[model samples]
Target: MAGSGDAAKEYIAGSAAGVAQVVVGHPFDTVKVKLQAHNTKAHRKLYKNASHCTSRILVEEGIRGLYKGASSSFVGIALESSLFFGTYAHAKQLLQGKYEDGKPQLQVIIPSAACSGALISCILTPTELIKCRMQVQGKDAMHATWYSSPLDCAVKTLQSEGVRGIFRGGLATLFREAIGNAFFFCSYEYSRYWMHSYTDSPRFAGNSNLILAKDVGIGIISGGISGMAFWTTTLPLDVAKTIIQTDPSPLSSRNPLRVLSMVYRRAGLAGCYAGLGPTLARAFPANAAAIVAWEYSAKVLGIRGS
Candidate 1:
């Protein structure tokens, strides 16, 4: 009962983080996907930049346009985050063995985070496939007749492609999540550690209010920077993932490296980083909200870090 209770709390905290992340980041993500979908030389470029993309979406679809696949994202991110944090929490503890009191070793954190990411990729792949398709649907005249909603998109995809179609970009997603999350967790943990070391003092240990405020601030900063690191290093893989998932051609190669090569040949190196602007812009704030929500909720639920 005690173990299950802890797990439940971890899931709840993670779910809170996920919801906050989607609510804050979905608009930025929509723009990023739009940019990636049309960055190829094979298609005429649509928007000039992130600002242009934002205005175009507004003119065409209103404020709701920026949130095209939000419904699916809310569900997807919530479940993904729940499992992610829970799995990481448990994995870190297991890897810690008997020395559970100290800061986790880099070796321990890396593999644990990687495992969490790989596990969640199973959920993220399908969710992102729906999201990318929905985002790119009405971006051009050729694709102006968009699916009515995420459900419609999923149903139509199932009708045309089957379960395999739904998981079309599984390999790309797996690589992105596994690699990106390793950097993410490592950067976050190290950031927090350094920040705490630089600022923390034993004198303030008794002041719970001050400690709470400091912790939140650090979490926000650490999470934001970590998010940027994740995207900066992995955006190419993400661009490849988006193309693989959204390409209408059934025969399009699902291999990420091959897709990247195709992108490079068509649009040069710049093509591989299609949505660098909005992705970096969204990374900090979205991830900041996520970490803060996760840490705060965990504190509230009395779920201590391993």
Candidate 2:
């Protein structure tokens, strides 16, 4: 089991990594959410694709517009990541028992990841609801009441829908996080194992002197692969969650299946992946940076291993 010190280090590292991820990835995330929640019939279809979304935001709303809801995202990510990494570390330590050296086997890692993902979903649901709502506000003429900031959005949601409003899409978030993170953590651990054990990749070869560089490199590779795996597993559920979070009607937002069915009726299977392009585009680089930061920070703080 990890000592108290190790747990503290893991939390700090995860929070730091979350900050880095939010700073680099929030813009792409904004675009992705906007596209997913956008309604072609309701709006004029301002953006043709991910690239078009980027250009439109740049031209019309300037740099600030692309970073909508960044403040809430930053805090939410920090808390969620801290809890996730810390929980994963604790779970792994417990599952691995007396520690037989090397890695802790896939069986232990996978369950640990699932536990962490489920736990993080509690925080992620509310955070994402606010962020998505803020992101799509200006996209439609009907939602023209501009939220001055994340705080404003939170206050409005609370006043309008009570505490339940904050957790609008909690079930969908739980499903996505549990299933997606299982694949994500497995892919990352397996990728790192392959790089070090099979490929004899210099980036992950056993060398204490190069541990920092190796951890960061391994993290980048693992994170990229995990991002792809995560999105692939959970995109459809994610679409359901986004629709629920962004729907103006309280009744509509409560039923994820109904929203998903609406998406299918409106655009079929393709509609279920409305923002796939932007999401995949962001997934690799964003997750790469996030994991790199996470691993490197952990190492610097004296928490070691994959």
Candidate 3:
């Protein structure tokens, strides 16, 4: 009973952090999505050089065009991050059942993190699909006419694809969420722990000002590490997801592994990482700002890191 109550509180904090992150960090995400979703040549032109792309977007689309799908991204990320944090904290608690003295044991932390990652993937699939489509922004795709506002996208996807459409390329997203998220929590907690001890007592379990700085710092560093992890481990899957999301055709019911191999054959290594620079750049501040929001959100929930 007591554990349940604590979980409720933690979820609140997590959700709050997510909301704050959307408010502060979404514009960068907007740019990243544009870069990722652009119809660049897979091995050659998919991602125009960052400077060239930025300049082109500004000159052609104006500032508004650069932020085309921002509304959808903001909404999607808010819900996604909130659910992610809420689940992550509780999952950690569940995995690390009481120690002999009755506290989170911390032994099963990684799996806990993984579970949270997986859960958030399911929750965010619908919004994520919409956001990804909007970010890429092509008129040729079948989904081009489906959205007006964020809600419109969600509704249209539901109506057309049933529950499944909402999860277009969800398998890839699932893998990305689970794997990338695993790295996120692990890096965040471990970093905080390291900062706390800097020597031995790893585990950021107390202190005020230090906790604030540590949480913010942890978020920044962990976000970057998580980005690297996703970039490396799931770049191929991301390529598939991006392709399917933007392509005019539906995700064939074929095995994802098979699909990935096809993409690899067609595009090769360079195709897989078309827009890595902007991705890493966005990951840094988006994550840093999100973490900053998480810390303040924790205080709002009456659980200041200290």
TM-score of each predicted structure versus truth: 0.95, 0.91, 0.80
Error of 3 at 211 (Å): 6.2
User: How are the candidates ranked when ordered by lDDT, highest leading?
Assistant: 1, 2, 3
Better of 2 and 3 by TM-score: 2
lDDT of each: 0.90, 0.82, 0.62
- Backbone clashes, candidate 1: 0
- Flag clash pairs in model 3: 40-46, 41-45, 41-46, 193-203
| TM-score of predicted structure 3 | 0.80
- Candidate 2 TM-score versus the reference: 0.91
- Per-residue lDDT tens digits for candidate 2, residues 126-166, read 99998998888664434634577889889988998899999
Of the candidates numbered 2 and 3, which has the greater lDDT value?
2
By TM-score, who's the top model here?
A: 1
Winner by lDDT between candidate 2 and candidate 1: 1
Sorted on TM-score, best first, the list reads: 1, 2, 3
Report the error of model 3 at residue 209, Å: 5.7
Kindly report which residue stretches of model 2 are placed more than 4 angstroms away from their true locations once superposed.
39-46, 98-104, 139-141, 199-212
lDDT of 2 at 63: 89
Better of 1 and 3 by lDDT: 1
